[model samples]
Target: MGTFGCCWKIFGVALAAIFLFFHDLCASEKAPNYTFMQNATAAPPISYYDYIIVGGGTAGCPLAATLSQNASVLLLERGGSPYGNPNITNLSSFGAAISDLSPTSPSQRFISQDGVINARGRVLGGGTCLNAGFYTRAASDYVRNVGWDGKLVNESYEWAEKLVAFEPPMREWQTAVRDGLLEAGVLPNNGFTYDHLYGTKVGGTIFDKQGQRHTAADLLEYANPSGLTLFLHASVHKVLFRIKGKPRPVAHGVTFRDATGAKHKAYLKNGPKNEIIISAGALGSPQLLMLSGVGPADHLKAHNISLVLDQPLVGQGMSDNPMNAVFIPSPVPVEVSLIQVVGITHFGSYIESASGENFAGGSPTTRDYGMFSPKVGQLSNVPPKQRTPEAITKAVEDMKALDDAAFRGGFILEKIMGPISRGHLELQTRNPKDNPSVTFNYFKEAEDLQRCVQGIETIEKIIESKSFSKFRYDFMSLPMLLNMTASAPVNLLPRHSNVSMSLEQYCKDTVMTIWHYHGGCQVGMVVDRDYKVLGVDALRVIDGSTFNNSPGTNPQATVMMLGRYMGVKILGERLTSDVVSN
Candidate 1:
């Protein structure tokens, strides 16, 4: 076989070995007893579950696994199973997995009202199936702020770590990133630890040593198959409600459609403890709630949908941790790397880096500037004169040179960890199949813009640091036809940057989301501390949507921790000695 084919065959063999190993580990426990396919033919006729969880995503998978330990549970996922999907199992396909815009791709790509391109997972593992795979325990302050018991939170983290999280092997590029972060004055290096702290540290990742990704779906191995039923490609349209002349409405069941458009209704078994939990991510949770008529009455009325509850905050206060980056082109090849090292600054910014062949393929360049399109160029305030043939040719040539460079070097990503600006989600149409309108309102607050500028400035400082000198390239040496001066370099800045180009305008033009969307159905506003939606019984929101604020990092770890916490609470279990000691 050719090299690529040989590699693929070996990868398949390795993955099979890993699967067998994990299967043996779960041998003492019950294997997942659930049904998953394209249709709902295997669904129980009674359709009664002690707990019916929507969106078998990052949060829903683990939560269902935990709850099924004691009660009958059902999980409904809008996408197919993650098992054997190369896009999900192979680390090399990370970019393509998230960027794939095909209707059947696991990721559902959407453009926000603000014109930013983003995506969310439609798969069983949710974001964990699509995200960059970085994992870190939520900061201690985050636990305290959420009013979670510290002991329980710690135990919950341990439970998740034992399943999917792993310590990544340090690569050459990652070590350089660590040195550069420390050189940027991020502070005393904390070495390697999963604890979120103010310094550079290596954390856990879901990618295994064999370069294979293990998703949240793997946690379902702990589930009792007899008690839990999982249905794939089952899109839930709305949460069914019942009112018996009471002031509040109770969630009785859910109405969903199978892949073949067959509709099914799965209700909670009649019991005081039976419930339906919505874990459909930040955008999805609120959209589902609004679709079910639990949002602002006025907004619901405008859509001509009868209101079941007058809760005004169901889809308000959406926050996505916005990110801006500096792509450094290197004439020499760099080693493949993911987000193993991270720099946490005190000023509400987190710095991270990624390097690999995947970075090279995804980087913006002159030849592929069409990806930005006329719309983005116009929104960027690009002057008509700049579109001249001569300028366009020169820009394309420069971009080609960068692309042809031996390696797709590293990228410095500055994420506004604590953004003050808020956004909201609204219905586009009442159709459950249609995507909701998401307005991030990024950089709306003056302080938010300033924070982004600070982050960019920090990135510049890191690039210029002596520790980064080895990775730096001499762009000045390239054959350029444009007016090139040592002081000015090339005119790459936006209008906001005058002599230095508009850093402010550049931010506006280039900013993208890190995909850590949260807080649409926030606590104290839409749900209570116990995750119960206000004015609704037998229903709860248990995903990133329930976060009152961002956890200041990649949110997969925290999302899983929350799922485990909620599962324990629903089971009425106290913190065990083993859990506490771990």
Candidate 2:
């Protein structure tokens, strides 16, 4: 058999049985009928809604759905629906959606100031539509630290989980990866859990046995469709604020451009409880704030935007969890998998793996995941936009020297949790549609580099463990393969080739984003404990933008949970205020 063929047998006895059960359960569930959904062009030039939500994404969809149970809500999405998109709905074509370079692609690709290629969600379901299907909640300590009620958090998780999450059916490669993690002494195996534990475990997935992805957009099934006005391709340009209030500026309305280049305005109704919320992701929330004159006064002035509030921390404290990986080219073709198993270390790092064809495609001549591929731009000392085909192949080919085997193997990856390193974001132009310039400054702090070193060491141990020996060529560790470059060894690290290589420099050179970036409109900085924007009335920021750190290994579950939790809280507040008013 060829290295990349899939004719190999699928599952062991236990796994095959598990797969059949989940296939029946998940295949029955489908996306909700969004009866209130419409294109932005269908909206009236001026509209009034009890609550207006910008960005119909991961958090916004649930929030709007929940809020609609009592009050009228206007949900604005900058991108089209994910409902009928095969690239997003099917797991067989895992990498196709995000890798599509078209202007209308559901995932928006951007290179950070750190020169790392990254992507952000552009579809209605947000990053949940683009991510590998892992689903896990924040740790118990994380909940308490953030001052959330434990019982309520669990309830919220259950609500979201029941709709989308599933017990992933493990295949051969993932099962072996699980055993290897245990063999490396990441001990006390907590089998099949969603809690963030300090041991090896199998977690929940958004993909079911039939390979269909259930995204955050699926949470809308719980929504009151009658009261929810969902408008797709509604690009919010600026937040409308009533600046002449007594104590601080108040958010009253928003101005948005519809899909056809026509402008529309939506205002909050005459009630103190009515408000506007920014549920855009980490990047979009801060960018919209700055555009609306709520960010740093000096930075806003650079583009001649009138200052609404001089909240200097609006775009401060940006972060992206730095990910490093060791790509292992198996002599045998491995079963296709996403992140199903994890090894959480005592130190702040996570180990996860994925085996399949390339995210972009399976063609041997093409580059795969940029993080795992040989970045010709780095070797040639040229920017990514400046690289050519001939220069790219010649410059970095010597470093990695990989071949078709790369298309057939899996990657063991590490991502540092709660990195101390930080960076800031700023506007590239005044236009809200244009991407802003941002830098994560990965490994900027010395401690972050040390964490990366520890993570790399753990990966080495896993690679050398007894359980994993069968997968490697001639029972060689990653380090051994690089040393004996004679046999076309799959060089995981391009810049350095031997055991004596500086782990620190290797970490810096090979750092990539796992896309768990958070903290632009952070809690206590831009928003309060209730997630309300500081110094602004009738305004709040929900979504990953308000997070202090990326929760657990995956933030999608918690991010969706927050939307439901806060919606309940806000609804309660409304009821209490009505009682007092009466």
Candidate 3:
């Protein structure tokens, strides 16, 4: 065989060997059979519901819980039942379970016409049950910065915390890394124990004192109201709406399809009295709306989808947190336990409650000031105007500098967060049966480069700190940065290759992301400040997609809060109308 053929053969052999080694690991545990057997007894169908929530994710659960209190609620989930699914409810190793990325129960792998997309939860509790239980609230200032109703936002957040039982999982968590965290000055103080978290390092919340995962499944498991009907395995194909002479169109209902090629319609029962809430998460919600003719008119036309009520803003703004992580091998590889991985390390809070040159002349809200807001603030220093090819090149150079040291360490860290990115999802096919095309144009944004470089530098500083010294962590530079006379693109070397490079070269190949994807439907671009679709009536999107700016923190809390706030607003509107009519 030729040299290329030889390499391919070896590569194939290696892949096959690796696959066999983890064959069992690759396969997820089989989920329960919720299949309706023909010729067998069929469960009673939900003939009608006052409210029909499209998803069962973090936002969906709370929406169902709150709205179903007095009104009849029907929750249609495309995934399997999470009630007793071991893969979902009992999973302790959040990282491992999600890594499976397979469809279980009624929820099959969500695919577009071309047939591939990121993982999504198709179970009863949706993504909330499957996602990592990292409950960090959006930085309060971000809520205000977006011009959203702040005090009311906080109130909504507080309500969400109660409904979902938000609790820090620090009490029983006991990890040695946590001690290392303390030494490294990364812990935030628990207000219950100290006056403030500012300066005092602390761990993020992972679990509660009760040792529960605090999953949405766990939160909404109790006291399910009889009015809410949960229909598992019902995949929404399109949002059904009616257009009138009024400036805004009326949202009538949704048309959905089941796994067995079955089609059904869940109409709005309360008439103008009821509304359609799309909380189908960042990806699905926008796709469903667009398929039903609710996004940019031109794009929908290209897909041959008939226009019902051209909302134009339906799927324009989208944003998410970029994630990056590394599996640091403990020097001694001690016997690992739950406490070891899921401990809390608190960092002191920023006392920015004061105005003007505060906190040692550092902008309290800025990271330079030591206060990292989860929801708002520009993390990247790259000038917005420089978000072009030339700027992207510069950013890549900067990233190389930050990641150079990481290569020296034994473990290879992958940048899950892509800096300098603006990506969007498009309808691959007119058929709602086919999923939408999702392109996470990571590293496509010019500013992403600078932000990633800063992230790398920050992480490196933490590793070099006195506290982290106890772990004997060292930098691992990639070999490509080594002096080369050729003027070519700085290619990334194979992560598995046994090689070493100079710090300069290592910096050239470094990349990272937070795995937080936000912004396909641009915030403020499509939705108004009130989280309402600009051109559509009775249609509100309450999910991560509503985020105008990516909250640097985990988005679960923000999304949940949005659901709560939106629920209250929609309900309040109804209540006011009733009072006026009376």
Candidate 4:
């Protein structure tokens, strides 16, 4: 009997091994055929593509997938795939993912000319692979202003949501934030809606129930694999222009370097519709244009780049939302949280919070919860008209002071959704690998500073509300009040002795970017309503750089929606039932 049982077990094990081998083969067949370690030997010598999309980021991935439905599309990304990176896939490693500072990490961190630290995504999924995973549809006014078809935009939002968006499971810290926002008069309590509104609401997130991040690259699953070719680590240097003293320049192909540093050129096929799209992001799109001699003639000349088109607006009119935060340390443990709740105030400010314990694992007793700074722009080398010398000098001084402050506890991030001031980005050198000089010119306008002050006051009110009274504590013998009294009027300045100077001074010094850079290649100025570059044919700039204005919220969803919208337009297709009701 024992010998018979052993024989049966052996047979079962052999059968299981055979089944696993077949399963592996099937899985490999279904996986997208991405070119790994691309080199001269790997890529064909004169490859032809109907459409070549640069920068496989937040906007590029979806756009390429959508365009590949009928056309042969080539999507080139600067960084490798995001598939097995623990820092990118895990929610707890959110800070380290962006703050890694490694050259090969998915994120490329850089400091602005104004001395504020910021980072942008370099991976296949772009910023979507590295951001806080917050997702929300663009405001209706933004849709109308950008001349996007409202119905189509809505459909595109659904398309992206179905793939990566998810409703977060609320936890302790998020619940407290929602209640406090309501108590502070950001009312109506819209309750778990993705629509952008002027009240507290639980929006969508890209992280699913398992806390695993689903990036925009996942949407490539819907792509027709037979028609799409994705080349990872294929860094595009410039758009090859065919200019024979013609009135309008034509883009014939692109020059890119593979991971092995061997140069390759991929040209557009012989079709009138064949084109190259630059979705290299707010900073990248402008840099590429300038490198290809399509930006301001004077700026390009300074860098010794031969001018193709004197499109002055190519790298101009840059703007980014600035953030300011106030950290409140709590000795007690706070629940681990991301941006599960948001408070949109009437004063053009958005309030969100993140738990420190969620990022830095430690015992509950040592965890700190503090409100960080509001989002704001940085001053550039050539300061704009609005950036006064006083403001610039004060900003440098304040950044130094804020850096020295102790970091403890969970903090609220107050971001000004809209600002009147605008800055510009220009190339420091002609090298495509060199980071551009980005100048946000934050608080150039007094109104912008005033708006920031209003946001700071609003944050104070929420922190003072009874909803947060449970976490209140004292410093020395005095209560940590954030320097406000219940009887004080809204306009009254904070009386906190710990504050360095006036509220405006504090704002000028501590302001930082929420990394929401936009308007480098604005719609009306750089690209037409259809996103085609004005002075150049067979080229379009799609990405955050094309945004006419910031979307007043996290722009990941809007960027993806725009990609889908453009792809549908290029395909010359209307919203079918399958596309709309996703």
Best by lDDT: 2
Tens-digit lDDT track of model 4 for 227-263: 8888887778889988888677899899888767888
lDDT of 2 by residue, 94-176 (tens): 44454355666777767788876666877788888777778998999999999998998999999999878999998878888
* Prediction-by-prediction clash tally: 4, 0, 71, 26
lDDT of 3 at 245: 75
- TM-score of each candidate structure, all chains considered together: 0.83, 0.87, 0.68, 0.82
lDDT by residue (228-298, candidate 3, tens digit) is: 66666677787777776766677777776666656677777865557677777777778888888877788
lDDT of 1 by residue, 1-582 (tens): 132222221121121111111111101122233453334555543488889999888899889989988889889988877766654445433333432446667767666777665667777788776666788987898888889989988998898888788888887677877888888888879988889999888888887777666777877877877778888888888999998786789999998887777778999887777899999999889989998989999999999887899988888898777777665544457776767888888877888877654343324443322211121122222355666657646544544543234324556778887678898999998877678898888888887788787777777777777777677664422111001111111122222223344567656755667778787899999999999998989999999998867784788898988898899888873234335556
Candidate with the larger TM-score of 3 and 4: 4
Off by over 4 Å in 3: 1-46, 91-118, 148-152, 163-206, 209-211, 221-224, 244-248, 311-313, 334-420, 431-434, 473-513
Q: Which of the predicted structures, 2 or 4, would earn the higher TM-score when compared with the native?
A: 2
Native-to-model Cα distance after best TM-score fit, residue 199 in candidate 2, in Å = 0.7
Query: Against the true structure, candidate 1 has what lDDT?
Result: 0.70
Total clashes, candidate 1?
A: 4
- Lowest-sum lDDT 10-residue window in model 2: 7-16
